[model samples]
Target: MLDKLAKAGDIIAADAVTRAIAKLSETPVPAGVHVEATEGGVLLSGRHLRRRMLGDPQLRNFGK
Candidate 1:
């Protein structure tokens, strides 16, 4: 029983780690956002930066 419990705990921990990795691997910014490497750090800007960042629904028809 103890061994089975440990195995289940290990599986749960591994699954948590995998989910964390997947979340971290995702891009923070949405597509169409410009990324610039500046001397200070990084700067993000674009024509639709505000809309994209805010997840505007109408963005689906952008540039159409």
Candidate 2:
């Protein structure tokens, strides 16, 4: 996926996913989860991706 994205001129998404995977030493990725790069951040195509990126949505403030 990163390869395809990189070839399509998406360095930002590719880099973000690469970094995210690298930091998965202790985290466990759930099944059937797809990842893609978005303008705001890396988009995890699954529910678990939420916890993987943001610890808890309710705990964070989106309206900075």
For lDDT, the strongest prediction is: 1
lDDT of 1 at 33: 64
Per-residue alpha-carbon lDDT of model 1 for 2-61, expressed as tens digits? 999999999998777666555433425456665554443345667867667557553433
Q: What is each predicted model's overall lDDT from 0 to 1?
A: 0.58, 0.51
**lDDT tens digits, residue span 1-64, model 2:** 5888667777776776667654442243445555454444544566665565466443233222
CA error at residue 12 for candidate 1, angstroms: 0.1
Cα lDDT of model 2 overall? Answer: 0.51
Q: Which residue pairs in candidate 2 have backbone atoms (N, alpha carbon, C) closer than 3 angstroms, thus clashing?
A: none
Error of 2 at 20 (Å): 0.3
Tell me how candidate 1 scores on lDDT: 0.58
- Report the Cα lDDT for residue 12, model 1: 100
Instruction: For model 1, state the Cα shift of residue 7 in Å.
Output: 0.2
